[model samples]
Target: MPLPLAPLIPLAVRLGLVATTTFALTRLVRSATHPGRTDQRAEDALDDLGEGLSLHRPADRAEDRQTNATARVRRVVRFRGKTWELDAGLMARVRLNERKE
Candidate 1:
């Protein structure tokens, strides 16, 4: 005997819609609460390094660092409402040297 799938189709569609709505709402809330490109960038870099490095920046200086880079290969980031200035080239160089040792 074949089972009935017609009734399950509507249920499945409703569940999918709910899941998508929840996901979208969560993202919207997160973005609104924390609004800064620098903060996001810094967090991503730290995650990539996996060096247990933490971010600390002064609230007053956050705006300035967010728009400026220390060097050609440098980037500014904000972490926990603080500004972090990172020099990617220098970091890479140091990492390379460590590997060569």
Candidate 2:
């Protein structure tokens, strides 16, 4: 008897289509270049975003980093239940943080 080939054939075709499409799109994006190229627009847009976007000013960046470092060194994790304060998580994190520092 012949092997069951009907379902396998369509699956193979779909896999081939997907592979070819992925290859084409990968080439499209990876081969990006300057003006007059296929992916010039995409490349230029990404370049513009990288050049234009800034989350913080240079003067404040140091201060922000210092604050974050200090907090990371000092913070304690805790879950508050019916009690006024939960000390189990807090004391453990504090001990660990203190040891690390």
Candidate 3:
């Protein structure tokens, strides 16, 4: 006996439909997991660098010997999103983004 083509047509249609849906879903998942769309890792790297530098002291005994060492040591950092601006003067408006957990 020969297999019926009419019965196989519905089965093939269902299988094709399922395969297309699965392919689309997998593509969406891959796009979602892409690095560009996920958490901002560069911001974390910058924060780590800043923290590491904060733990070290630069070789500037001349400035340390001065009476205005505190004034010279003061720093103003303005970080918006991924952009960062550093100012070493007074009377400034520097806003920083809150660190993530």
Clashing pairs in 3: none
In model 2, the runs with Cα more than 4 Å from the true position are 33-101
The digit string of per-residue lDDT tens for model 3 on 57-91 reads 33553334322211112345566655555533221
TM-score of 1: 0.32
Clashes of 1: 1
What lDDT score belongs to each candidate, Candidate 1 first?
A: 0.57, 0.47, 0.50
Evaluate candidate 2 by giving its C-alpha RMSD to the native, one decimal. 20.8
How close to the true structure is residue 33 of candidate 2, measured as C-alpha lDDT?
56
lDDT of 1 by residue, 1-101 (tens): 99989989999999999999999999999988966466677555545553333344445555444222222245789999999987552122111112334
Alpha-carbon RMSD, each predicted model: 16.9, 20.8, 17.0
Kindly indicate the candidate among 1 and 3 with the higher lDDT.
Answer: 1
Runs in model 1 deviating more than 4 A are 35-101
